[model samples]
Target: MNLLRAAATVSSYTLLSRVTGLIRDVLIARAFGAGSITDAFWVAFRIPNLLRRLFAEGAFAQAFVPILGETKSTRTTEEARVLLDRVASLLTFVLIGVTLVGIIAAPLVVSAMGSGLRGADRASDFDAAVWMTRVMFPYITCMSLVAFASGVLNTWRHFAVPAITPVLLNLSMIAASIFLAPRLETPIYALAIGVVIGGVAQLAVQFAALARLGLKPRISFRLKTAWADPTVKRIMRQMLPATVGVSVAQLSLLINTNIATWLAPGSVTWLSFADRLMEFPTALLGAALSTVLLPSLSQAHAAGRKEDYSALLDWGLRLTLLLGLPAGLGLALMSEGLVSTLFHYGAFNAADVAQTRMAVIAYAVGLLGLLAVKILAPGFYARQDIRTPVKIALAVLVATQCLNLIFVPYLHHAGLALSIGLGACINALALLTGLRRRGVYVPSKGWGTFFMKLLVALAVMGTALAGANTFIDWLAMQQHAWLRVGLLLAMVSGAGVVYFGVLFTLGFRPNQFKKGGTPLV
Candidate 1:
């Protein structure tokens, strides 16, 4: 597959999902506002969401995809099918058990996640969160299966299906918030119901695609058969360390959620809104690039093509810088305006916008690092070397909590965002250092010149954005949604024009961006 083409396919679909997700969030903010109800919903939603990432997208995908790709490339078709079935059987059994337990232990989980809710004043929100948690628990089981199917398709180079599956999630939530919430006595339960529906829908779409690819998994409970499979054992081995590496990052976020619970009523909601905005660029670029790169990297490693593996990593990093820097800086610069324009209306007041913007800027400060983790972690995972990343993630987690202790006292919820960014930067740096120390990756030539050009381009874009910012009254944006959106679009377009124009003027060409899957000299 053409790496650039595949990334674009994934990015385009992901962009659509984020756009709809933004709409869903906008409705949510209008209906619920940034308070106890919204906070409860976010916390409840996060329990299943975080577990889905930990089990499905993060460690599970990392472990499954490499092995799946290798099996497809190096083994017989019958053998690969058997491996897939056995893995599916084991995952299905485990996830079902986890889902049942998670539902049963919702109160304990909620209490552990947000102990601040234990206060008498917050008991209502605590009970609400626990109920919502049970409602959303089954989502983990559905998405775990979806993730496995996604791995199968990604190994088969069916990028569009998995990329597009997230749209169902955004649509389900949007429909729930707008259409279902108002009808319900407790509106937030609609969102939880939508979560379960979306998970099932996501799983169904991927399952259909897998059937079309003739890779439909045969489900079973033959533990002896599964344990007898060497490939399954290898995946389990990789999953152990990969889980720690993945979970530490996610656990840090849970820690932030825990910390946010004690701050103020709107703290959880504010951080969540800012995080949604960050996910826009992150899903479009970071996730899309990582999704496409992992299988390719795995393919290279499986074939013992050391040089190709290095070049793919080099190519991914260069692309990371090319896109990530401008995105992070622009987001930090435009946080206030962007938040107000997109989200400030109805129950989401100016104060909410202000708080969310601060978090946005804080999170954007480490946007590059966040994006880098997506690209870099795959480098380690593709090689089935999970210990290095787990150690690095653990160290970063510790330092981040330390920063959290220091910054939260001063920065409030925004400090949590900042610490997350700091942890991401540390994580990315450690991954890079490990890659270099192992001599598995070497930077390509012209990196210095490339970065210099990037700096110049970024400066030009910043200047353009600053000039555009002068004409808009941010306070007035809350009253005129269309006007705000129009102005934001124009400013973003002009900034992009200036940034890319400068790069073009400095001898960068479209062809340069398209040149991937080539060995670096």
Candidate 2:
């Protein structure tokens, strides 16, 4: 399969998900605004959302996909199918227990996640958060299964299903926000309901795809039998270190969320909104590319094709810089324009936009680092070396908290964003160094020239974006909403043209990526 084409397919579908997600956030902002109520919902939503990342997207995907590739190559079809059944059974049983615990302990979990909500004046908000948490807890189970199916499909070279399934969740939320938020005594509960509904829809579609491909897992109740399978045990063992790595990241996020709750009324919501903006490039470039790279990296490693493995990493790294730099520049320089245009209406006021803009600018500081880690960490994961990343993540977690102490005192929520970004940069550098020391990856020829061209392109793009920011006051343009949207679009489009045009003038060609697989040009 062409790597570029596969990545494009994933990115395209992911773009749809992000667009729908933006609409969801926009509606929520218009309806609810950034306040204690919105904060309650955001804090509650983070629970299942974090677990979805931890289990479904993070540890499970990392541990399961490598082994699945091995099974398909080394085992008989019957054995591979059984492996799926056993793994799925074990995951299902475990998450069901977790869901039950989460529902029963909703108050405790919410308190731990956002202690500020526990204040006397904010007692009702805390209760609302707990209530929403209970309602959304089941979302984890459905999403984890969805992740299982996504891993299966991606390994089977069907990337579109996994990429597109997220749209269901976004659409579900949009519908609930529109139809349900106003009807209830507490409007946010509708979003929690939408979470579960979306999860079911995503899983149903993914399972349907898996069934069509003859890869659907037969979940069983025999815990003993599923646990006894050596491959199942092996995946569990691999998941141990993978979980630690993922948990460390999630733990940092939990701490950050808790800190945000204490700092101000809407800090959590502001940072979360800023996060929605950041996810666009991260999802489109980083996630979309990594989704295609990880499975291929595993396959290449299993076959003992060292050069192919290195080449794949090389391609991902170069592509990350080719696109990621300009993305970061756009984000950092056009923060006011982007934040205001997307979110500055109704309850999302001028103050909210300014606060969110600060966080967005701070996040842009580490955007490239964040994008690079998506490529570099897979270099370790594909080799089944989860321990290295775990250790690095632990260190980064400590570093992040320390930075948070210094930053939170001054920059408040934006400080948290900055710390997370810098920590990502640190993690990416460490991962790259480890890959180099292990002789797993060596830089290819023309890296210096490539770096120089990117620097040139980024400078040109940055200047264009910065100039465009001066022409219109994003906040002042709010009454003329369509004009703000038009100006933002033209600015971004013009910047992209200038950036790539400079790269082409300086000897960059889109067609160069097609030599191995897929024409990215």
Candidate 3:
């Protein structure tokens, strides 16, 4: 696959998914508001959502993909099919028990994730969250299957289907928030039910894609045989560290959520809204880059093409800094406008906008780091070196909790977001350092010049944003939604023109980014 084209493909689908998700959040904000009920739903949704990351996308995919790439590259089609079947069977058997246990322990899970919900004042909210968590627990099983199938599809270079599968989740949740919720006395449950529906839809699409690829994963419970497979043993071994490494950022966020629940009634909701905005670029660029990179990196590593591997890493880092810096800066400068324009409607009021904007700015500060980690961590995972990243992740997680103690007292929810950004930055840096120290990555020659150019471009963008914000008055534009959207579009377009225009003048060309078969040199 051409890494750039593949990444653009993934980013396009991810953008669609994120756009639909924003609509879902808009409806949800209108339907539930940013109070106890909405808080409860976020908490409930976060439970399974957390695992969906920790297991499905996090450790499981991280471990599965590298192994799958190696196996597919080295082994016969029949052998690869057998390996896929065993992995699928093992995941199905394990996650079924996990989901059942999660359902049974719903209340405990809720309490752990959102201790603030268990307060006497928030007892009803806590109970609602528990029920929602139970209802959504089964989603983990469906999503795990989706994750495995996606790894297979990605290794096979079928990117579009798996990329678009997330759109189903957004569509289902939007439908739930708009249609199903209004009919229910407690509307949050509808959103929780939507989680399961979305998961099933995501998995179903992947299965279809797999069938077309002529790959069928037979589900069996013959644990001894499956477990005895040497590749299965390696996956489990890698999975152990990969899980912790992949999950540290998420674990820190979960901790932040736990802390936020105690801060104010709308604390979790504000953070969630801000995070949703940050995720637009994070999911679009960060996820897409990582998704494309992992398989390419693995292939390069397996082929022992050291320069190709290092060049890919260099290209990705430059592109990340190129896109990530401006995205973060733009979000920070335009946080209030973006939040107000998108979410300041119906039940979401002025105070909600203010709080959410604060959190958004805080998150935007770390956008570069967050996006970098998505690319950087894969440097380790794609090489099947999970331990170093885990060590770095552990240190970052510990430091984040410490930062949380210092910042939350002053910045509240925004402080929590700042801590996450801080952790991501540290994690990305450490991963880069580890790669360099191990001689696994050699920085391209133009990096110093590239950074200088990026700094200049970002300065121009910042100046442009400050001037626009002076007259735009995003909050006032809320009364004229079209004008708000139009002006916002204008600001983004102008900023993009300045940033990329500068890059072009600096002699950055589209041809610099070529298909994966080509090296940066």
Candidate 4:
């Protein structure tokens, strides 16, 4: 696989999804605003969403792809089909059982995630959280199946459908928010319904694609036999560490949510909104690079092309820094403007924008670290070394909890943002250090020069944003919000132009960093 081409394709589709998600969040803010209801809804929704990320997206994908890629390479088509069928059967059974347990335990889960919602007056709020969670819990089951199918399709070199699946998920939510949200007695209920519907639709779309690939999965009680399969064991071996790593990450979020609940009414909503904004760059660039590079790296490693693996890893890291750094800087500089323009309408007031902006800026500080993990973690997974990440992730989680405790008291919701960001940086550093120790991350000759140029470009970008923010402030004094928004956007575009244009002029061609068969280091 051409890593760049795959990254481009996945990034394009993911960008579309992120854009739609932003729109959805904007609409959600307008309908629900930042309040007790929104907090309850977010807490409820986060439970399943967190599980989806931990189980399906993180652990499952990390494990499934490399094994599936190997299976496709060595096994006959018929043999691969049987392997997939057995794995799917077992996965479906496990996911269904987990979802049933989650539904049955919804109340306890809500209570754990939202300790603030106890007592006589807030009992109704706690009930809302439970109800919404039950409604949304089925999403975890559907999404897990979808993730498994996605792994299969990706291994088959069919990325478009899997990449596009999230777009359908976002669109489904957008439609429900637009039409169904207002009709419901509580808009949060509508959003909960949308979550479940989107997951089902996401799964259905991938199922259609699987059918086209002649790999339609069926639910079966075949676990007794399937669990004994060698390929399944290999997958499990890879999955175990990843499951722990992802669970640690999820637990960090759960901790943040639990803590945020104890803060002011809008704290959870503010954190969620800021998280969505930060995720745009993450989902677009970081996720795209990881998704595209993993399969390629796996194939390279399987082929014993250590040099190719190293070069690909270096190139991915450079690309991540190149894109993520400026995006983070821009978000940090324009956090207030972004929050004001995107959400400061209807029930979302100036205070809400201020709080969300703080969270957004704090999140921006950690953006590079998060992006680094997205790029770097794949190096271990692709090499079939998942255990190290789990170890590193555990350290990161402990660090995050410590930071959360230290900062949240002083900064409120924004402290949670800072803690998560710092933890991500620590995680990325640990992963990279481990890779170096393992001899999986040999430094490339161009890394020094590439990083030098990137830092220069980023410095220039920051200078431009500072100048533009000053100009925006001057314009804002005119008291025209629309003009301020337009000017701020223009300023951001101008910064991008200067940054990339200067980089190109300084001999920083994007293609120069592309990995060939040989390792540059």
Tens digits of per-residue lDDT, candidate 3, 1-521, equal 56898889999998989999998898888766799888998999998889989999999998999999999889999999999989999999899999999999999999999999998988999999999999999999999899999999989998899899999998998888778988998877889888899999999999999998889698887888999999999999999988887688678878899999998899999999998999988988899989889998898899999888888888788888888999999999989888888887788898999999999999988898999988888888889999998899899999999989899999999999998998788888888999999998888777788899889989988998998798767776667888888887888899999999988998877777775325522
> What clash pairs does model 2 have?
none
- TM-score on alpha carbons, each prediction: 0.98, 0.98, 0.98, 0.96
Residues 439-466, candidate 1, lDDT per residue (tens digit)?
8898878999999999999998988787
Cα lDDT, all candidates: 0.90, 0.92, 0.89, 0.85
The most accurate candidate by lDDT is: 2
In model 4, which residue pairs have backbone atoms overlapping below 3 Å?
A: none
Q: Which candidate, 2 or 3, has the higher lDDT?
A: 2
Candidate 1 TM-score versus the reference: 0.98
| Candidate 4 residue lDDT tens string, 334-429 | 887788777877788778988999999999999999999988998999878888889888889899999988999999999999999999999999
lDDT of 1 at 1: 62
* Every model: Cα RMSD to truth: 1.4, 1.5, 1.4, 2.2
TM-score of 4: 0.96
Rank order by lDDT, top first?
Answer: 2, 1, 3, 4
TM-score-wise, the better of 1 and 4 is 1
Candidate 2: tens digits of C-alpha lDDT, residues 1-521: 78888889999999999999999999888888899999999999999989989998999999999999888878798888899999999999999999999999999999999998999999999999999999999999999999999999988889999999999999999999899888998888999999899999999999999999888999899989999998888888989999999999999999999999998888999999999999999999999989999888988899898888888889999899888888888998999999899999998999999999999999999999999999999998888889999999999999999999889899999999999999999999999999999999988888899899999988888887777677778898889989989998999899989999999999888877754332221
